[model samples]
Target: MPVSDLTAALADVRALLLAPDDLVRAVAAGRRRGVEPPAAERVEVRPVALRAGPHLQLVSRTGPVVSTVNAPLGERAAAAVDDLLAQPFGNFHVETSSQVLQLRVTKRGEAQVHRSATSRRAVQAGPQAHDRTKQRLVDPDDPLFRVLGAGGDKRRQVDAFVRQLAPLAPRALDAAAGRELRAVDLGCGNAYLTFAAHRWLAGRAGEDGAALRTVGVDVRPDVVERSERLAGEAGLAGLSFAVGSIVDADPFDGAAPDVVLALHACDTATDDALARAVRWGSPVVLAAPCCHRDVQRQIAGARAGDGLGGGRGGAGEPLVRHPILRERFADVLTDALRALVLQVLGYRVEVVEFVDSRHTPRNALLRAVRTGGPRPEHLAELDALRAQWGVEPVLARRLAPQLDAVRALA
Candidate 1:
């Protein structure tokens, strides 16, 4: 069929589905050959059953004709309609199964095809597509965009990061001491993530009456000043910036923080942020480590001599097999150890990709939400693992006071 014709037909089908009674009346009228029926002779049209498969069948009975119309569309006719709307223009097969309708489109001139699925009653578009299509008022001349936007590439990356973090904001707020929550962002460089987090939390607050206050901390005085100015321009109240290193700044000294965020904190700075979050007993902590200095140093030292003894091997065998490979391996090992430590300390930890690696090589996000007191065995295992590795986890050392020996045993 012609694309225009198909489009019109799909629209008609959608309209028909939306107003079944009107569809029945139209179908009944179409069946009648223009002869006016007597008042008592007017027939009632009632739908018997509508079934969807490779074809759509609408069974209805009227006066003379027990009519059944078949459209070569799946049972999930509404989903088929959605699929048709999503594409620019193409030949597509729509399959319906209970609540889901799958759409597969084949281009006319190309061998390649595209496929997508939608719930029969899904109201919103998928997260990926929704996020991508969302328009942000980020003009090139805009000072805020100039500082925060790292071109289109970095802006997309920032969006993805914000979307990933968006889901955890509510849970974090729920765990806060009160309806009003506070968050601190360590090493908030350009404050892209910082702003995104604030916006997201603000949206959540609007929806649930959970007010949030956010403070962005960076070592660079100029960046902090710029960030504060940007926040003011954006009209985002309860969000501010400060110039300080994570190690020196006590964000929760006077008032406790509900969440702590440190995205792409360099080397030991990520450790410092995590340590501060733990010490403050912040319910939620999200960090993406940019470098692995501690582990790299350990790997370098190991290369000079032998590996640390533990876990199915002795000190003689090389821990990472090769020097270059060991450095890379240490990065993964470092993040893994951080996650394990978080888990041991009674936090539910998730290690997942926060954004595309092309945007930033440090794409991994460590999402740790404090659940309860640490189990006794968890503490013992943490100690044992630290001993086995012969390297202290900086986060573990900093939050030692909060680490309960009895709870670890329990």
Candidate 2:
């Protein structure tokens, strides 16, 4: 992990410009230039082909928002990267058909290379610019897409949402064969993502070029009707929308869903959606929870009550002594409990920021994929935490019936 190795590792990354061997993804970030690029905390580089010729895209990122431009890949791309290394502010992460590297570059002209090489998931390196809201997955010309306009934010969200699904597709597909793969979007709202998922699925080719079945549910009747109209206009045959509550919505409609998704579903609604997904034992679950009021109220109540029952961290004494800190504490505790519950029920769970926090304060995505039973340690931890807190989450109550089976499975 010496910084001296960064120079050679970067040289190897530069070799990606040689073309015939190709590149996958590359990035140079941090404040190496002394002057930071406008709205760009870092820069990303990728080889792309345009009608004119092969080029490298220089994408500048300031938080979640990004601005990119194309330049000839030969000298320009090489020199740009060289300048970055010369001033090297942050880590350099590079992936190519031939190698995968993580170089921690310091301003002192030193680099710590953790992974200098790995031969895995090689790249075809498409010529055109890649988009999160891929036209292939969310057609702009489609009447529905035209009406929606698919702005940069929407496109980015679509891209981010689909990206998370890529790694689990194989397992999900294995569970879904012969029949079309099924997905259900709880709180489908205007169904922007419902359509995104459908278009995404349409582009997903299986060995049989199989079709996909998807449903979107929202409480608002008008939005459901509007989403349905859009689907009709877009000529998407298997996608549909319905009016229902995430709490009571039987989105599966008697069919077992391969994926259950909820984006920014508010408060306990997210818990409800996730609980239902777990009970169904769905292979994949994605939820971006909003409004931590439920847990916040519980925290306030605990402090107002006897000794804060001091959940898992309760023994740490008063973590929530102030209003602002109380709010943040509740948010973390809520998601932690959610993750532990999923782990207890035989699903691998990860809570991650789904987007740049600058885009929205509520940006966490609780993603889970069923991978068999839970570990005993996870169950014991969850049990002890619950006993200490002396309070239950909305999702915990809903999942109570399965608690015994969950522990037994573990």
Candidate 3:
């Protein structure tokens, strides 16, 4: 950019930051000319309220280590933005209370800017962004993409999976933490998520100078063979698949994984995957469960002597009096206990509606990150629920040996 144009951009940035409640978020990223140290490769600025008053947060990211500083919205905030833009950060995205604006720098050092004043908001809420410019790891035309199929819904599912992995990835990339990430996918029918995850990590590794590898395991020999074939055809050397059950499969012949996944694994298979992930001590674990038949059956087992099975005599009997309500209750109760067990196993767990219900009714996604050993409060909640429910969850029963230690601590 010319010196005159550069001056104008900085002036405009300063005015926005100085304005109250006008600047929603501003990000300056993608280094130009690959500058040297302490000058973070990426920086983000946003408005937030502190104990003192309103402040702007400037977060600078240099590889795995990030430095953040809060400056009141004024000259200091403007300087932070100016410093980054001055270094010629190649990308700019500013979202205001009114509209969103974008600026981009070309390889020829020419600035290409665009601004729209329409009062519109982003479709998705969060830091999850899908870069349209970059070549997707799994292109729609590629053989791998064939597994996810043609629908935009399937594509969105893949994109969402990749985007969600971005925030938690830094822990694995920490300079002191291991830079190599090994991921295993259990019950990977067609290995859709397996390939997406490997590609996602591969992209991150390239940007952060790390390493990544993956394995996809399934019991169906044909699907496993197909996945292996696709990996070979796509030249994905770091990814492989084998015909083995989620409960028995050991990826790469027993290599411990840094992340474990079980997307849409059926019935008790989800439990098996979680138990394996816990055993692996994976830094990140995620699952999109397919069915809750096990819990539903257990809940229905409490039938009266006639065995007509109308929610007989359990603590939450009336809850299952209606068939549809029983199904919904089983899903909630099943996931609740699963989250509780994960918490007891030192993981901070969250249950999310990963995909739209239109895609599938069974859309619950379980995301767990290893934090530390079990917390007393979380375990107490689990115990109370279990005692009241009058039935042991499959996961709780399977993980009893581990849960016992956590209970002792509780």
Best by TM-score: 3
What shift in Å separates residue 374 of candidate 2 from its native position after superposition? 3.8
* Better-scoring candidate (lDDT), 1 or 2: 2
lDDT of 3 at 258: 76
> What is the C-alpha RMSD, rounded to one decimal, of candidate 2?
13.1
**lDDT at residue 116 of model 2 (Cα atoms):** 37
Candidate ranking under TM-score, highest first, comes to: 3, 2, 1
Cα TM-score per model: 0.63, 0.66, 0.67
Once fitted onto the true fold, the runs of candidate 2 whose alpha carbons sit more than 4 angstroms away are 1-21, 26-144, 205-208, 307-318, 388-390, 408-410
Q: lDDT of each model, Cα atoms only? A: 0.59, 0.68, 0.68
Instruction: State the TM-score for model 2.
Output: 0.66
Encode model 2's per-residue lDDT on 52-118: one tens digit a residue: 8877777865434678877776677667656655553455556555555656544454555645344
The predicted structure with the larger TM-score, 1 or 3, is 3
